[model samples]
Target: MKVTESPSYSTPEVSKVMDQSRRFIATASDRPEDIVEKADTEIIGLALQMLSDGTADQVIIVTNDIPLGEAAESLIPKYGFTADQVTWLTGGELAPELKEDFVSEFD
Candidate 1:
């Protein structure tokens, strides 16, 4: 699952989490674990990192999967991401739009 929001809604906690995630992604090793299951933390870190990196001028992610949805919601508060910084796209299945879940702002 993914969300799309403006920076205005970003919270301190979210910013901090995003920071950690970004750092992980920017410097990840080329090893298989770095890009795969061995690095769940690294994946989350990379996802958030991409969001702040501006990989796309505009982006949105849509998903209704319980694991992803719940985790995303929980992480928002824990991370302090604002409502706007976070978004939910209601749907029955994952699709191309959801691919933007990894939006990044890095050059």
Candidate 2:
């Protein structure tokens, strides 16, 4: 589980959470089907809407509480987005490998 913040988390906070998740994933080998008892259905619909309406270049996180992957996946057919449209928010692990303007100023 990730600890998200309102108004979004900073790069440092995101890094911290990702690091902890790596440790947890390494230690606890649990299946998502059995792990998550109550799923957030609202998020799925919301994400789908955002994905359909929002541009691929933009990340529209309406409620910061929603998981990034969950939110992105919900978009699916809305905007014709594949895994390529979404990038894991890696602090710096693959920054050198990125070709898109993920951190660039938007118009």
Candidate 3:
């Protein structure tokens, strides 16, 4: 979805978070021209917004995308959130029980 189409994007805080995520991804990527995807950034942006708005004490981002996870980790601290305040998990790192459930759902 376009960033503007996000229901939460109408809020100033969400909008700011989204912009930060986009900028970070652009500058951080080696191939800046190839990093045009915004969905992953939007997910990170919403997670950051929740932390900023006090909606969540901590946020855990579970994704197989390594770059996206790294981006979230790097950007979290820039927004005044500490490492302990957020967790990034890859599919391989998921607990056995969650992995079973995850697989079952897709199957």
* Local accuracy of candidate 2 as per-residue lDDT tens digits, 1-101: 22332312243433333333333333333325333312233333333334444523434333222243443444333445666554334333445445353
Query: Per-residue CA lDDT of candidate 3, range 1-107, in tens?
Result: 12323327777766776666677666655446346477877888788777787878898888766667777887777788999987999776776565554542111
**Candidate 3: Cα lDDT at 79:** 81
Between prediction 1 and prediction 2, the one with superior lDDT is 1
Q: Write the per-residue lDDT of candidate 1 for residues 10-102, one digit (tens) a residue.
A: 445445654443344334433332342323333343344455565532223344433333344445434434545555454533455555564
Ranking by lDDT: 3, 1, 2
Best by TM-score: 3
* lDDT (Cα, 0-100) at 24 in candidate 1: 42
In model 2, the Cα lDDT at residue 15 comes to: 33
Which ranges in model 1 have alpha carbons more than 4 Å from their true place? 1-44, 54-59, 92-107
TM-score of every prediction relative to native: 0.35, 0.27, 0.67
Best by lDDT: 3
Models sorted by TM-score, best on top: 3, 1, 2
